[model samples]
Target: MTRHGEDIGRWLATQRRDWDRLNEEQQARLGKLGVKKAARARKAPAKAATASRQGKGGEAFQKGLEALTQYLARESRMPGRAAVQEMPDGDIRRVGVWLANQKQRRDRLHPDQLAALAHLGADWAR
Candidate 1:
């Protein structure tokens, strides 16, 4: 006998467009086979808009991320929270707080933090 499992996989691919039109019994059968309906496609412009917003800080963010990554690599540890807290510049302190809160040592800086660090300049990197 043919394997119903393999047949269901093939059927799902071909029937994707007609998914909503399938009768309750057919839908239940697919459900039992662990087949899920595909998520609705997002409009391209929506993605582009978000990218533009992120792009506002992308370059600066990249610079800060590179600096932080290099610092962590060479130092094997980050500066104490107090060092950042005591920084004369508010922007630098914010960047320090952001770095302190990261769960992993290798995590990249946030876009906003990168922008702030960029404003703080090459000194922040060191």
Candidate 2:
């Protein structure tokens, strides 16, 4: 069962399409097997809310997933907890600037992020 799960995970992580996670060609082939993708989804793997979002595009994703997870977790949170990272270099830079501009070491966070940071104050200080 674990191996079957791994196979499914592996297949989903190397998608190449820009807007659609599984390309039209692959969907057509799968459709022949009577497993057509639901029309409700047209966005790519990056847009999907699953493990594929953590693995698509290879090593970079894994490294990023690690760093953000490490940064956001509270000591009491379990290792497998989900994390929402503030990625995109531009965004990170913007956040840094915002943080710096606020002058108060604890100010300038997005409301939700501020709440999260408060919840993990011990981790943040470290």
* lDDT tens per residue, model 1, 1-126: 238546855666746646787888887887887876666555456445534655645554454455455545555555454433222233353334445444232114444443544444423432
Task: Give stretches of model 1 more than 4 Å off.
Answer: 1-50, 53-55, 79-95, 98-126
The C-alpha lDDT values of all candidates are: 0.50, 0.40
Give the residue spans of candidate 2 off by over 4 A: 1-19, 39-126
- State how far residue 2 of model 1 sits from its true place (Å): 68
**Shift in Å, residue 1, candidate 2:** 4.4
Clash list (residue pairs), candidate 1: none
**Candidate 2 lDDT over residue span 1-126, tens digit each:** 237457653443323222266778887776576664434434344234332333443343334334444544523352232333355453332222332332244322233343444444424422
lDDT of prediction 2: 0.40
TM-score for model 1?
0.27
Best by TM-score: 1
TM-score of each: 0.27, 0.22
Which predicted model would earn the best lDDT?
Answer: 1
Model 1 weakest 10-residue run by lDDT: 102-111
